[model samples]
Target: MSKGRILIRNGHVIDTEPQPVAHAHTDVLIEGGKITAVGRNLRSKGAMVIDATDRIVLPGFVDTHRHVWHSALRSAAIDIDLGAYFRLLGQVGPKFRPQDVRIATLAGALECLDAGITTQLDFAHIAYSPELANAAVDALKEAGLRAVFAYGTPVNVTAGGKLADVRRIRERLADDNALVTMAYAPLGPLSTPMETVARDWRIADELDLPLTIHLASSPNNEQPIFALREAGLLREKTLYVHANGIGDDELKLIADSGATASATPGDEAGRLRRAGITTGTGIDTVAFAPGDMFSTMRAAHLAGQIAEDPQLTAKDVLRMATLDGAAAMGLADRTGSLRPGKQADVILLRLDDLNMLTAERDPIGAVVTEAQPHNVDTVLVAGKVVKAGGRLVHADLRRTARALRATAAAISGR
Candidate 1:
């Protein structure tokens, strides 16, 4: 984690915390993989200088929930709905070997970095074996991205796959530091039996790892938030992903239990709408949802505005992508902000990009509104440059894409 001194000079910094936020023309000094200072004209001797002029420096985006393994299969689910996705993955997943997992993880991780997602909670369900699990972890390390490898318990929970296996993986990866962390990803309560879920939660509690589950809305099964509450299972480390249209009682219980929630609005909004257009359950959607976190932010903002409860400011909307997301992963102390003591996981987006030609004056507005991945000029993870000059470092984009296609072809027996 000891990335050497990096002096980012003369960039407008959107430091989202500790008052006096969003300074213009600020210099940031990073040392030993941590932010050392943020001020005007800061200098560090013998530091690697990065020209951040004409760029807006912000804490890199954090994605609270993502199935990163699918990076190898980009747009695979784009045309399909929730049911088709389940069917497709169910058929193709078993054919993937360890090498495939490694390639997919690395590709996915790079995609996140390229998109300016500095920290990601990668819900890795493909690692049914330890070798596969280690492969995913290794790829994350090699990608030099900050990630939480949310280890999923196996399909055959009756056999070798258990919390002990997770513990063993943790022991194997004991050397992993802040750059690559661990999490407990288990089948949600509605999917698995309550007894098994109870055991998994107990194991996660004993291990003191954050637990994330997809409490997705399904009419086929009765909502289980009340059941989880009755079972005394909710905790601060508990994160419910994409619990859209959840009842007020469930939301209140989740809040009272000190649990967190995350929304991958792209997947949810798209799935619902696509399902409506397709053969699956045509769930009603009030607003048209697109495929980015910005759309998610917009959805949340609109919801808050419509309710007249608490209208979100630009900062409030941005916090869901930054501090709140890190809090969901229990990583708020490290990588979420641009604090002096935090890890130097930062990104610079070019305000000079074509998308920004008609941009608003508010920095945070652009971040939560119009900024695209192509606008990412530079990205640093743990103070190391993983993306520079709007291109991913240490990557052969064309070759990687080709390899991914070959992988898909092999999987499909083409």
Candidate 2:
């Protein structure tokens, strides 16, 4: 194995484990895509060293949910309700050519790296063709980010052809696991036929790959749960996204299936649009948000509180965003926490930041409530410096932003 040279020193390591608050200073040694050592007075020659004296080192955030294609549409449908937004996305989604997906995904992936998100579950639903899927995967790889490219089979494509095409694409792209993993992302029940969704799940199971689907995004999707139950397709391998409208029975089914759930509170709150609905109706669902883990933690904490369970701790919320999320995506063995032998995917949060300084005693509390994207000083994906001083090292932010603006304008026909 080849070793990469990099050293991070003089930082307060804030891993998931709870240690003494005052034990702050430490050195981290990174060699060949993994953390070789972490302690005081670590020595290494001919290695690049980063001064992290005032920063808080942590495991890089894992964003379990995001529509990367919607990066250009940030707040585009802010005034429109959910129904209208869906209609608009449905119309606009297919209009995007493969080039558009490449640009949008590249921009979104770069933004995530800049925001200190090391690993992301990019639910790419804009894959109207195999070329679009390949383009999105290529963009993620070029950005040097870890991602699971969930290849979405558009309803139109499935209706136009047979299931064999989906299988062929999965087979061709399943082995390329350098920085990107391929997963099956079937459009959820409301838009896609239940039979196709089940067929997709069967293929996913046969290939032993993680399967993701948008579920219970609205009240109308309740019937899909029953359909899944009838088909006996609800299983742990199935990762359900935005399952806000699920009930107790569905929760039991999920628990029995050993499946996992991801909830994006920020997007769910209609920050982008009214979206008609107020909150997802899922049961025992975990909270999630792309690009920002602090907000996701807070949202999970609040959701637990709303369920009359005020005893939920910040650590619990953090786990959902980190470890639980990795398990949900079936990548727990490789990443998730800061442990020996795990990939060195880590982030450094500035403790002195005003938002993070309030709770000095509880590091978890500081991370969940006080830390923001700006507090991120450094981010490492697979033991590489992707973000330093809160800026992307390999991304051209200004140009990407301009391109996204033009793409959005074109889509809106303005």
Candidate 3:
């Protein structure tokens, strides 16, 4: 399919763009990979018509940060904290061959698509060699998911040693309009020298790529952003992941510098959002949490509700999973909403599903609070139907499952 026309008719449409709004019994028309119209009874001749009755039509979710290379190790470190998780990575990270990395990355991207995530920023830090880096990029391109492949230093490896490989991968993925783009993922001042961080930032700037970093996840790292600010490296096109445990002043600085923040489950995403920052939701690692945005949204909402302010509502988290997430990834102009001019990254959820049958009164709340990946009935990326009738349209699941199992066994030495 070469970005053909699509007409999704008569559904409950929800979108967060310009502003969050919902429309009932509306139609959305997509042509040449872009949404051309969104209204009642829209007509598009020769378009592939999809009946969306009893479905919730919305822009597909955007995951701002995910270590996609960890897919084969799902639940391996489920009970560990951040420190132990890194230690686990040090143990298993070196065991993965380039083929294994490709399998894990492809599996992870497919998982994202199955859960209605049309776009993701893959915080891929398993690129231990040039072969491994190329393999990971190959996997993303093969999976056909829109992604920002944020290349980074491997765990248990020397930080900033892979800058040249980052450039190489950037050169390979130079087409920004393609599904797979490139970014730089650096171990910020917390785990690397300021000099190394500067080098990483300069390489990223030279490549004209975005920079994403793990910052303020621990108390010792809470001040790394300030250091970046002092070094004059803090700027837009940067995503501060795990802005957890940071103070209001730091949040203000991030907001002022036009930088965005992303938080996994149980982080201060709500705080960042409240401080006028563009806070996106991240699955972070599937090693400990569900990969789907529905679970991530619920976790984020709970994190906010338990906070003193309790101002993060269900709709707010939905935005974090959608438009805000795209903004965090610096691709809001192309995706993140059902806006007429945006790319057609959309999904349909079966509102009549058992879990959502009676939740029509607050559809957005239902999506944020009650929906699950199983409720996703159809998905489209760039006007191409990748999923329909509650199943992936082009995936070879049996083959993928076999490869994943083999990769896991090989990695675990089982």
Candidate 4:
């Protein structure tokens, strides 16, 4: 609209950049997909103006780690623990055909957008074949979300792509500036041999792609971070997911290495933050946890209070969901905050909604503690209006629903 110029006017703007700040009755101007100005009474010729009155305009949420393809199996293992969840996925992962992966990934990405997650690092460990990997990436592009499609080994599958296939996928996703980029999601030191881990890290290093892997969420006592350090494979481009049950010493090592960590709400997120690690919020899986960042932030806050950690405040949790998460995924400079020259990945939440009606005094606290997905009134990615007036634009939800149901039924034999 208006030749790629949008001006959001008269909103309570919140920014989580160098630090968290709130500006009342502010305006934002976006031109050609980049934020040009954020202040009072901003003007742009031929700009399409959207009134953000009684709305919380802020940077969209970033999910540092998510198994997006598993959204097809949502709540399938909600009652199970990590070990049993893996066991169940062992059976379910192999049953996903290429088309099934496509539908699941598309639905998943749309779900993320609906919940105000403008960016996600998809830990797609379901690449059972080259075709499957392509299907997942294609679905991300189709859904139009900013994503990092981390190519990884499929679970419990023998005849599928291996570490070498990472190189193959890298060839296809070479453009780093695209909406959908690539990462390497290798089985880290805990699951693979030392030599295999070394090789995978080298491949990712050579490709200049970020590395993300699950670490320290299991009962095993192995020090995966330490192992990476001793092997000289630890790098800042690596994102360690679910660093639960890790000791303080290991957390210090993560901080010292300049590496980042992702913590799902139910995990040891508070501990990670208390240890001074740059922790970000992750939904982990829709199959087991809520997909919305509001719920994720609430859970993280409650967990911090339960642990008696004094460092966790509402602002802190909000930062974890926004700028910190972007930094964790190495995209902070491009899309995290409401700053000039950054991509316009932003959302507006209606403060008039019953769930958020009392957010006038402490908007950040209400956002973390009271807001829900239904309050999201508008969403934009790269200056494009993906959602407006509480509905997705150019989306065929009925069709997506039918395909999702058929795929889930086929996979479940129901």
Each model's Cα RMSD: 5.9, 5.5, 1.4, 1.7
Question: Which is the better candidate, 2 or 4, if ranked by lDDT?
Answer: 4
Give candidate 4 regions above 4 Å deviation: 1-3, 158-161, 217-221
Model 3, 220-325: lDDT tens digits are 4558778888899879989988875677888899999999988885758768877888988899888888999999999888878888884688878889899999
Q: Pick the candidate with the highest TM-score.
A: 3
**Rank order (by TM-score, best first):** 3, 4, 1, 2
Query: Which scores better on lDDT, 3 or 4?
Result: 3
Cα-lDDT of candidate 4: 0.87
Off by over 4 Å in 1: 18-20, 153-160, 217-221, 266-311, 358-360
Worst 10 residues of 1 by lDDT: 277-286
Local lDDT at 263 for model 4: 90
How many steric clashes between backbone atoms does each model show?
0, 8, 0, 0
Clashing pairs in 2: 4-32, 82-275, 244-280, 244-281, 244-282, 245-281, 245-282, 246-281
Per residue, candidate 2 scores C-alpha lDDT tens digits across 4-90 of: 767788877766533212236787788888877778878868788888777777777777767787776666565677667767777
Comparing candidate 2 with candidate 4, which one achieves the higher TM-score? 4
- Report, for every candidate in turn, its global Cα lDDT versus the true structure: 0.72, 0.67, 0.88, 0.87
Superposed Cα deviation of residue 246, candidate 4 (Å): 1.2
Candidate 4 per-residue C-alpha lDDT over 1-414 given as tens digits, one digit per residue, 9 for 90 to 100: 222989999998999988888888999999999899999988857999989999999999999989999889989986878779989888899889999999999999999999899999999999988888999999999998899999878667542237567778888898998999998888777577677788888878888889888888343327877888899987888888887667789888888888888998664777777777788899988887888899999998887777755647888899999999999898988988998999999999999988787696887888889999999999999888999999998689999999999999999893
Can you give the lDDT of residue 265 in candidate 3?
Answer: 58
